[model samples]
Target: MEGPRASGGRAMTGRSGKGHRDENFPVASKLLRPEHRAPIMAFYRFARVADDIADAADLSPSEKLHKLGELRRGLDGDGAPEAVALARTMAERGIDPIHAHELLDAFTQDVTVRRYADWDSLIGYCRLSAMPVGRFVLDVHGEDRATWPLSDALCAALQVINHLQDCAKDYRALDRIYIPADMLAASGAEAEDLALTAATPALRDAIVATAARTRTLLEVSAPFAGGIRDRRLAAEVAIIQRLAESLTARLLTRDPLSERVHHRTVEAVLLAGGAALGQLFARRRR
Candidate 1:
């Protein structure tokens, strides 16, 4: 719901994606040190705005694709200010531009692909849409390459969680469905069920099953918490991991059609505090 107001062009203002806290988990939040803000924000601005374009209800598929291409061009040094800033940051940090490019690939896919055929297909989508984010963060911190597999898993899990949370909205508003077709069939459901005002029992069962699958991904990626070198980042990942786990559990048993499933403010504060205290004790051990 925190998407951009425009359908296309350079009409997007910085105010559009400047400080949205709706990422479900912390992204560019205060948990990170101040110095990390600008660069992270630069990347976030480009990605966030691009996401807005892809999700814009008023834009045609061709129109959305064009805006996404413009973003790519900006990264190549000839587009919007947000993309230019992102390009400059990537160059100065010696981070490869390919990571940002990966997101472009996904956005383009969003323009064309409206439904996922199966889990492998969905994960393939995640490789482009999600994995780059974790890779970008790792590159920013200069973390070791060995940690990438776990990071990839965690990021992919987060992506799936987001997809599931917005499943109803995505279907109704954008005519997109990230839920796998196979899973829906298994539950005696179809993609059309998502457009209903209320989720039927079979539809809810399928969604819960998918949530359970996402939870397994989080478990596999849990070790990534210890693998991070930056204490703040580690704490951040810990909080995210915890939040993702909590959200998935809620999704697994709840009816996605009838209610919301998310962490409240006090819950977020507690999770962050737990992560920070965890880092404190971790440092004492070191």
Candidate 2:
């Protein structure tokens, strides 16, 4: 549990992207009930470590995969500190281990798969990588399985938004690419265009086009806020949905290759607060 935190000894100064705790998007944020935080943080820690392993430019591909394999072993009760913490937390919270395992499946893909053939293929990756976070949270709150499809849409949208924001960084730092190949072909663009200091018209068009696709997921996820059984979780989900859509809107306008697309702290606070107010009104009407 503390092992990962103890061994690194490196302080996260925010831009390093060196740890999961340094992540820009929310995970286990304050919206959840107090009791749920521990398991969520543990899960985030495990995910962060695995991401670190995959993104380690100094490590060879084989070396990175081997570290990821250790994380996989944590599911079976033996792995690194983060994985062990995840296993114990799952057992304690009665949370299923499958979500974490599925994440590993995606991380393993990161070690090998670089190009996506089509939209469906890319979504197949999201089913493993992005969808699990939502599923696990629902499970922690004891929500029904019927909500998963809507949750999947929201989660996948959030995931895609992250990819779009980091397209340039992913290409430069991790040598990873998540944009589907077919979409780029359709736009007469290639992934290399993202590596430039500024996005070419073709690359910007491709991202704008992709943002349209991500928006469809948000549109389909409209029912997610109401589907949750817990009132508190409903509010939190609403806030996240709002944030995702807002960021997506920015994606459609911003030059991600050169300009920042993420919300500042004050902007995010306002967005989340607005979502909370909307949820409150919706609940009162119901």
Candidate 3:
């Protein structure tokens, strides 16, 4: 029997329907042009399914690794439905399959590893887990090398911010800690500090410092928002930056140990509106 076509049969629909809704879809859907939305959604769905496989707590690390290997084969045009769907999208968009592969490799690492020893180690993880997402987004937007470094900075910073925000939850549930173990040790903080009912001065100081570092990275990437020629793309970048700024501010004000900080719906709407207005002004200036 002939193998299923890479873009046809059950293979074309892929693994997207089997798991959690693609987390990136909501953000990507909002950011992409209407015509581009379907392909972007498909890409996010493919990535999300791979992520779910790696993140499934019920699966042993060996099982996750095996699944990830299958995912990699699928990316290579083997007839796995999700991989086929993803490969078809990549074929149409000129997206590098290497990026998708890198993401799976990262997910596999996460399943096997639980803690980062230092900032360098953490950054190594980001290079695999976070930087590829930025590259994927840039590929979707048809951005070139001139913008990639900045996009990587932004994506890595966002990943770091997410780690800081989810520190407690990830520690409690996954035994994963994105914060450098060395830093925590050096600060005289223990893993137990994250579980405290209130933020101790040491823990609070560490988190605040990390948030500041993320803010610096975000600032470095800010100019790229203005560099994009597409209005909606510019708005998307602006909105993300504004949200980061807002989150950073919230982090600064809240007791991280006692209160989880998150942007409220109304705050998000206003920030997005403000970002759109800022983008309009930027375009007018040019």
* TM-score of each candidate structure, all chains considered together: 0.91, 0.91, 0.87
Q: Comparing candidate 1 with candidate 3, which one achieves the higher TM-score?
A: 1
lDDT of every model, 2 decimals = 0.78, 0.80, 0.70
What TM-score does candidate 3 reach? Answer: 0.87
Question: Following a full C-alpha superposition, what root-mean-square deviation does model 1 have from the true structure?
Answer: 3.5
lDDT of 3 by residue, 1-286 (tens): 0000011012221232442221211255355598565666666666666666665656667876787787778887884577788888889888887777777778788778988898778878878877777677667778776887887777777777777877776676567778788777767778888777787787777777677777888888888788876677777777877777777777777775578676667777788788879888979987
Instruction: Tell me model 2's lDDT, rounded to 2 decimals.
Output: 0.80
Q: What digit string (tens of lDDT, one per residue) describes model 2 on residues 207-282?
A: 8888989999999997898988888888888888898889899999999888989888899889989998999889
Q: Cα deviation of 21 in candidate 1 (Å)?
A: 2.0
lDDT of 3: 0.70
What order do candidates take by lDDT, descending? 2, 1, 3
Of 2 and 3, the candidate ahead on TM-score is 2
Q: Candidate 1 residues 89-157, lDDT tens each?
A: 999999999988988898889889989988889999889888888888778888898999988888888
Q: Compute the lDDT of residue 181 as modeled in candidate 1.
A: 89
